[model samples]
Target chain A: MDCTIVKIGGSIIDSPEQLQRFLQDFASISGAKILVHGGGVMASRLQKALGQQPVMVDGRRVTDEQALKAVVMVYAGWCGKNIVAGLQSLGCSAIGVSGADADLIRAVRRAPVPVDYGYVGDITPESINTDFLTLLLRAGITPVFCAVTHDGCGQLLNTNADTVASCLAAALAQTGHISLTYCFEKDGVLYDKDDDSSVIPEISSGMYRSLRSEGRIAAGMIPKLDNAFAALRNGVSEITVTHARSLLSGKGTKIIL
Target chain B: MDCTIVKIGGSIIDSPEQLQRFLQDFASISGAKILVHGGGVMASRLQKALGQQPVMVDGRRVTDEQALKAVVMVYAGWCGKNIVAGLQSLGCSAIGVSGADADLIRAVRRAPVPVDYGYVGDITPESINTDFLTLLLRAGITPVFCAVTHDGCGQLLNTNADTVASCLAAALAQTGHISLTYCFEKDGVLYDKDDDSSVIPEISSGMYRSLRSEGRIAAGMIPKLDNAFAALRNGVSEITVTHARSLLSGKGTKIIL
Candidate 1:
């Protein structure tokens, strides 16, 4: 069976109205589907509320012990459960989970050599438990995942949501065709940063190299595109970057090999 | 198959060492089993950190909007995921969940006619989705549940963990024999509030009534025992109140019909 994996960014999740609309579209997706989400904005806000200053390096959170607790609370607890509840209200049977739940994803703590990203975990397709995921998909249940994974030795680790989605897509692709979508605030990869309508319809690896050389692609989007290309190189059938509202509209930039 | 349902109170959850020990014992329980947990102490601490004053009426949290969010973060997020991770480390396949997940347990919002408990939910045996739970149990996955439930209309509500355990036992009893256990700091229902070793081996309905009439039962134990009796009336096979350490020792107060 074909599977669809949709990952929503923190911008969409931070807004209740936007999240509801996105979930409505997500619930309408037919076939086996999964939702992976990031709650960085909320997690940062919670950290501030608790008097901990959030540190970010190169657009990635520098998770300390305190920050890890905040993310676990926000991502797995607040955002994940609320999203599941919203989907359930729309008549979609959704199960909210962290990677630790059923050992769905086991991550190794990142080696703190170059830069110590405390409690951050790095994962690949090998880390996913595809058998259990297949079981859930076969049962007609949509899994809603938060970017909280666990090391097999009983430690919860914070992971990048984009990495989780891409790896999950790659893992699921082993059994069947899988499509991965990255949904955020933008329409797609834009030709002009200031223009909303300047979405580039498609991008090839050659074009991506030139775009990077010309500094046309935003620095922030580099990691996402890298993840996209990696998923493509693995076994993912297709990958797209699009606005959250245009999930089923086929109005996103599709990545090409 | 026989199933065991155990509910741990907030006191045990607030201490890391205590919780780990409890999970180790909980993991060794054979057969299909479930864990229900309460994180009230942690929730209250988070609530205070978030600048919300937790109000309790009759020992039940009067969950306002802020308190609701705090509990959701603490119970379902931090505590639930951590417990699942701990159990997984102990070689137990555990899945952490809130009531909203897969709509495992749907609750009705409490009516305001009785002093308004802002966002509280009440559940019964009929509220449980036994089919899905059975599927998980048969698949050898032990579910770790927190005290957060949701109304079918997409609202998460605070629920008493003891009620969740008893109700789940009653619901699962429809298909098979179920034993419910409530574990806390105390060895069992005590004969005297001041005496730690004065554990009551057993209590019948007659003794319970007389104890309550004589004011011998602790005020807090009343609701838990009430839930136990209700579960017995509703078809649960057996119920026990025991200390967290004596889960498998067969030493505790047994409730008899």
Candidate 2:
């Protein structure tokens, strides 16, 4: 069996119209699929509204106890459920979940010796419950995941959505062909951060190093590309970075090993 | 096969220690089971924090757009996932969900003819997707549901948790024996408002009618008992109102026809 795992970033999720449009395109895709989403923008807004300061270090959120609650409320509750409802309206059977649900993705809390990202977790391919995921996929249920995980011991942890998608793809790649797609506000990984038309058609490992050395890749895209290459190495068949609306058209950057 | 459906009210959910104790007892239940939860207290606090006023009419929430968002975040996002994680820590495979997830429960938005409850939905036994639920139960996955439903058209609505439990019990009763239990702060239906030890052991329909007629029933307990009777009439094998701590003790008010 073949599976498609799409990761939508917070920018797309922040806009209702854009999200609905993306979901419409997503619903049109056939076969086993999963949607992993980021809700950082919403979470930040919620934190601000609730009198908590949103803090970030090296583009990763510093998820303190309050931030964890905000992310869980925004990501799993508001954003994830809305996406599931939207997909359902488009005739797709979508189930929204966090990694804690059914122990789908158990993560270990990151060590505090390095930057002290409170309540943040790191996951791997082995952390994913592929058997359970396979059952749902085979049963025609599309899982919509929010970027929230657990430590297997009752503690919820905030995770990066891109990492979640990559790990899920890598884990599921053991049984079937898996296609990993990163959809965000931009058309693709841009050579120039200011220019939308500067999307690199494709990038190999060597080219990625050269681009990084030349400072052509945006700061925000380095981690995403790293996750992409990791998935490729872990048996994922294909990886693409594209705009949310360009899902069906395949107009984006493809990552190759 | 027999199944237990437990509905935990907001009062119990508002206390961490009480909820943890209840989850421990719930994990000890040796059978297929489902947990439905209400987070009205949390939702109300969240609404106030977000500068939104929560209004209730006839004990039903007036779920305007903002209120709906607050409730969805608190119930489905915060409360539901935490419970799932707690149960998972206790070795119960729990999956948390809203009604929109997998289209598990589709509800109809209430009409404004009688009273306009904005974004409020009404559901029945036919609204539940029992096949998907049964599949999860057979797979040893305990579903933890939040009292949020969808209109099957990208609209999330606020629903009473008690009603959700009764409907689920009635719907699942078509295939197997179902027991519906309502867990709250008090021990059971009380003979007097101020007496915690004055639990009415059993109540028949005649006694219920007399209690209601004599103004002996509390305003809050009426709807819960009404939902219990509805479930009993709809083929549920048993119904009980018990304290959260008394889950395994069987020391509660049993409703009989």
Candidate 3:
């Protein structure tokens, strides 16, 4: 059976209705699938409530010791468990996990050079344990992962959610057909920034280059699209950028090679 | 293979050096073992930090919605992950889990009768999923559990840690010889509350009744011992109450029929 790697951003996660709808769609998938989610919006909000200032370089939060702890509590503790429980309620057997749980993903603490991204971990394709993941998938258990990873040396590192999804898709691709879906607030890669309905139906590699040159793509969408392309290059069969509530449909932008 | 169910209370968990030493000793156990931990101390501390009051009725904390969220974050998020990471550092493949993770333990929400225990969950021996747990253990993965369970219908409920351990021990007893161990602050059941060396090395059910009747046992130790005896009655072969740092030895109190 084909495996679908679906990633939901903070927008869908922050809304109960959107999350419930998304999970229902996710649970209805015919075969093996994985759901990777982002809870950064909630994490940042929580950080503020704890009187800690959130440091963001570009769109990525700088994960200091305090931020890491707070985010782990928000993401893994609240967000991940709620999702897993919701899936369980929907007759879907999903196991919530962090990288630290089973050493499922052995990541490296990102080197401090251009940015001192404290307690941030980055994983290569080598870091993914397909054998371990395959075991769970084969047992008909859906693996719902939070955006936290570990260095295999007693550190729980906060990694980017989109990156986590992309890396997982690339690594799991070694075994079978993998479709990477990026579910976000917008329906797709919008052609006009102000127009919600002006989603680009599809974007080919050549067209992506032209759009970038013309500055048509939103700045925030670049990193995610870049991740999608990276996954495609590595072996993921398809890439869809869509609204989470509208998942299980080709209602958004499809990235083509 | 004999399975050992080891439960560590809040005392050991509050100290890092002690916890590390305990985990190291726990990692060295001869056969399949499960680690169940308590985080009530930390939960209380966190509850206060969040400006919430801890309400205890008849020695059990009344789990309000706010307190339940705090404790879940403290137990399942901060406390559980650190223990799992520590075990991983010690070369043991430990997976941190909450009941919500795999539905490993399904519990009934404590009903509002004598006291309104807002979000507490209680599990019987039948509530534990042996087949699923057996799969993890057979794969050479140690299951580390936090003091959180679910209603199997989506509600994540706060559970008593000591009760969780006892119930797990008795439940797992059907498949193999199961030993239940409670590692706490004192070396064992103490003869004198203030004396470190006053460890009661052994206690029979008759002796426990006499000790309780004479007021020799501390008030806090009663419920724990009660749980231990209940596990014993339910088919658990051996129950040891010991110092977490001095585990792997008969250094604590042994409960005998």
Cα lDDT tens digits, model 1, A59-119, are 9999999999999999999999999999999999999988999999999999987889999
DockQ of each: 0.90, 0.92, 0.72
Per-residue lDDT of B92 in model 1: 96
Per-residue C-alpha lDDT of model 3 across residues A100-161, encoded as one tens digit per residue: 87788778999887998889998877778787788889888899988888888888898888
Docking class of 3: medium
Q: Could you give the DockQ of candidate 3?
A: 0.72
Number of residue pairs clashing in candidate 1, backbone atoms closer than 3 angstroms, sequence gap of 3 or more or interchain: 0
lDDT at residue B166 of model 3 (Cα atoms): 92
Assess each prediction's global lDDT (C-alpha) against the native: 0.93, 0.94, 0.87
> What would the per-residue lDDT of candidate 3 be over residues B204-252, giving only the tens digit for each residue?
9899999999899988899899998999999999999988877887788
Please rank every candidate by DockQ, starting with the best: 2, 1, 3
DockQ, candidate 1, vs. native dimer: 0.90
- Give candidate 2's error at residue B217 in angstroms: 0.5
Q: Give residue A56's error in model 3 in angstroms.
A: 0.7
- Candidate 1: where are CA atoms >4 Å away? none
Winner on TM-score between 1 and 3 is: 1
